[model samples]
Target chain A: MRYAGPAGMDLEKMAVPLENICSQCDYKGTPDCREPECLMGFARRVLSYAVQKGLLDVPGASSLIPKGDFKHYYPEALVPALAETCRQCKECRDNHTPDCVVALVRSSVEYTVLSDSIPYPGSVFMYLARIKEQNPELAALLAGELSKKG
Target chain B: MGDGIFRQKNGMVAIDIVASCGVMTPEQLSGLARLSEECGVFRIKLSTRQTLVAVLDEKGAGRLVESLPGLGLKVSPYGNVVRAVKACAGSSALCPRAVGEALALGIEIQDKYLGMEVPKDFKIAVAGCLRGCTDPYCADLGIVSSGREVFDVSIGGFGGSSKPLHGEVVARRIKREDVFLLIDHVLNRFRALGEPGEKLGRAITRLGLTPFLPPAGVKEAQQAPPDDFVKFLED
Candidate 1:
């Protein structure tokens, strides 16, 4: 199937990157998504989340991640675990489970930032509390690991 | 000392070099390198708007801005003026997929309107095609090539803020010449209506797009929102 449009215009090639970037997402063609009018909105939101979480404080991580938080710094242990969730967010675009923990945390973090109810250190604790409320077993596992390190 | 030099939190001044469409001739590049060396500039940053930024002391900044014009480089205008026009390589031998001459249009726009005072910093971007490599959809005024020498004009797009907006397409498949007239209309309207320090996108958001759009666009805006319960009661 060919798009019989104007000359020297390969609509397919031009449209490929646009389509491929969000093709498998649930919001691929949603009106709210605006045909992916968002050039870097999701990425910005993710970076915002990382900033609020103090994820950029880890050594060697600052160079890779976008700068966000300037005041607070966190321990290095949080990086690998948070990165695993980011990997899930990147991969599970359309295959997201109904109660996906990563999605829940990401949405809650963004909402917290937007609402501006709680400040940073408090917001960090709130994110953890929300995670504990949603997935007690996962929270317990993380708590155990952190206690062991301490 | 010039408007192009902005003082930073670190007590250094950032000098803006208007590298139009991010293009610099080899001679200009060499001149910049020499100037940087002579003026005690330590770092140079490429701004997202296709301008080059050099960090230096206040005295060094004054010297650099003075020397830049000799290398055929212009300093970007500061404070509520149209800055450099951002553009992508359009329809050149290198970029065959482009539907129009984006760089040429960008140059024309910059020549005519750069440094023009408005209510705020007005940004314009041109893309050769739908690929939009230069992110034309995120400019105050955006021109995207729809066909050979034909353009789709959009207004009130913005980015680099907490809230970013995609410019809405107001004119579709218009001729190259009409673009300038459309831009003139938009800029005049924006200047008249916009508050000081308010971005064009914010103005459009605050006041509805009706003032900026054409008659057909106004009609579309009128028809877009569904009649609410309040309207029903009034009726």
Candidate 2:
């Protein structure tokens, strides 16, 4: 299963010590890995690592919700090694990735100020976007918390 | 926090490893790989401008930059500055088709002009022959070698913009020695004419190439190829 998101990468080859949430994703093995920062091409590498580590039959994507201790296992920013993916992307010419929290939050700050949405800041999408930009480390935590509400 | 080091969202710093003319020694490359491992960075990026980029913590970034000079590596200037010269492997006792000293001339240009402040980023490319492996035609200032001793200098080329344009020839069949003088004149003229935030290309487009061209007698006859060039071609 290929978990496609900012934190998604083969567990074995991962340089950082983040939890291998990608191994247990339901969307792992799906073809919808269009997210710019996701390492979708590492399926073989992940499988090899899984086999070696005996991490087969991992849980679904939902089971890995609310990744805790954002500081310890937060999705890292895209490194130059993965820059090839961005080089081939059309969106990167104009719109950067959501995981580019600093740039995104800085731009969103200007957007929020210019639109003057202070009077009617009721959009859930806007809230998530802001949170993701301001503190990507905690955005997943909030998402996990929100999922428990319904 | 300094030149060539950009702070990333993850509180890490990205460092640009300057490899002039896209060339790096084996020792330098090995040093870079070792640095990556020490910093816990597994990947080193090759930037479009022929430099390496690595991401690491602030402390590691500082140490890496400090150690770069020992490995014959340095950082490129960010923002509006003259970038490192781009050149093809021409006539370097290596490339057979090359008729000009591409690497030597590119190094000369880089030593003289790299990191000079400009209104916008300035690019320069040197091609050894008409094959234009360096794509000189698309740089802010371009030099194409017609022969070992002669060159064609073009100005105001622009690429990677919404309105990309090919530069116009300003000096035809100039001598090897005149290239630097012409560059000096171009930079001076650009500084004088360019408006704030205007690129050399945009300014040239609006003002015209007449301002950048060399004196009428300085350039050889436009229609005639130099005798040496014809001889080189025949051989």
Candidate 3:
């Protein structure tokens, strides 16, 4: 459940601004939506992940409905994805569908990164356990990572 | 002027990217190609570690470095650091005995230890199975998976020894869940107990490997994969 996080990060202080920033966002639920490339947004992304997984709920998001790409945040989106369906495949012509293998890999990467930032065992499991049913590979990875940190 | 910058013979700098473990997206590869063409850098080599041996002039390196985080690439130190985990044809459908995902585990190791100071050059390799395709036994720290949820962890088997020792297993039939914990504990112990600049195996040879195991013993380390790890692989 526990993992290493970025050094010198103030998780408690960052939580407030992160929730504030995401509450004002219009693109919060877009499928595989990336955090805008910046420090503040990155922290907000992790907090948003926490809130969505019922790990931590920011006070403001209680009012909004769960709309937009619902599958984007769960293992439901990883089942059909395969390495054969990579998004960056030079040879592949089909440009539709969320089954990109690379996207799945990226999600695994994001999951590991997010877990690392959370800094606790129960919390990391909170993320990995959520996706255990939909994608076992990520769960294995999360365990491996948690062990590494310990 | 930089700590990690390497001077090259071709009026270029060699920036070592040890964390990639040789996988890259087509878009990332294309972006690199464009960068090369634009900068006129002569060569890009994938080194033995399956990392980029990218050679670029100083100016070109600055440009490339700025864009690297965007592409999810990092340049880590080359020597006396925990080198990137060299993975083989394990963890995927390729190897029949895959008890673990070598790339995923390798990336985890890379993320945690890359460029961290070590006593001396340290090489690590992970194999999903015991076929030794990645030469785990020949590395400073070699890990070989032995079961659906078990791994064999060893230390000190570099080929350079006149009589190179096979990586002596510090812990055998370890649970996949505990592999990382064992590795972390063993490495930290090695750092503390080893002589200055000593290789991990040599240090283990002198101190004996018993002190590195979990207090509960190696037997405790063997178990089924975690529920999620199993589901990911089968369900």
Best candidate (score: lDDT): 1
Candidate 3, A1-150: lDDT as tens digits: 764322222234434533453454556676534443322343344334433322221212211111222222332232222111121222222221112222222233344223322111223234456556555675565455444412
Tens-digit per-residue lDDT, B1-235, candidate 3: 1235689776788876643567788988887778776766668888777788778778778877777777677775666767777887565444422545666776677677666667777788888755567888898888876554567777887867686777877777776667777767777887778777788878877888777655464463434423432222222
Error of 3 at A63 (Å): 55
By lDDT rank, best first, the candidates go: 1, 2, 3
Cα lDDT of model 2 by residue, A1-150, tens digit: 764422232333332211133444445567743222233222223333333433321112111112221222122332211222122122322222222212222222222222221111223445556656766644455465445422
Model 3 chain A weakest 10-residue run by lDDT: A57-66
Give the true-structure RMSD of model 2.
21.5
For residues B1-235, write the lDDT of model 2, one tens digit per residue. Answer: 1378888888888888787677877887888888777866635787767778898877777778888888888888877788878888775364543555777788789878988887778899998766677888899999987655668898888878787989888887687778887888888888888887788989988898888777544665323422432232223
RMSD of each: 18.1, 21.5, 18.8
Question: What is the two-chain DockQ of model 1?
Answer: 0.02
Q: Which ten residues in a row have the lowest lDDT in candidate 2 chain B?
A: B225-234
TM-score, cand. 3 vs. native: 0.54
The candidates' interface RMSDs, in order, read 21.5, 27.9, 17.8
Q: After superposition, how far is residue A142 of candidate 1 from its true place, in Å?
A: 51
**Which segments of candidate 2 are over 4 A away from where they belong?**
A1-150, B215-218, B221-235
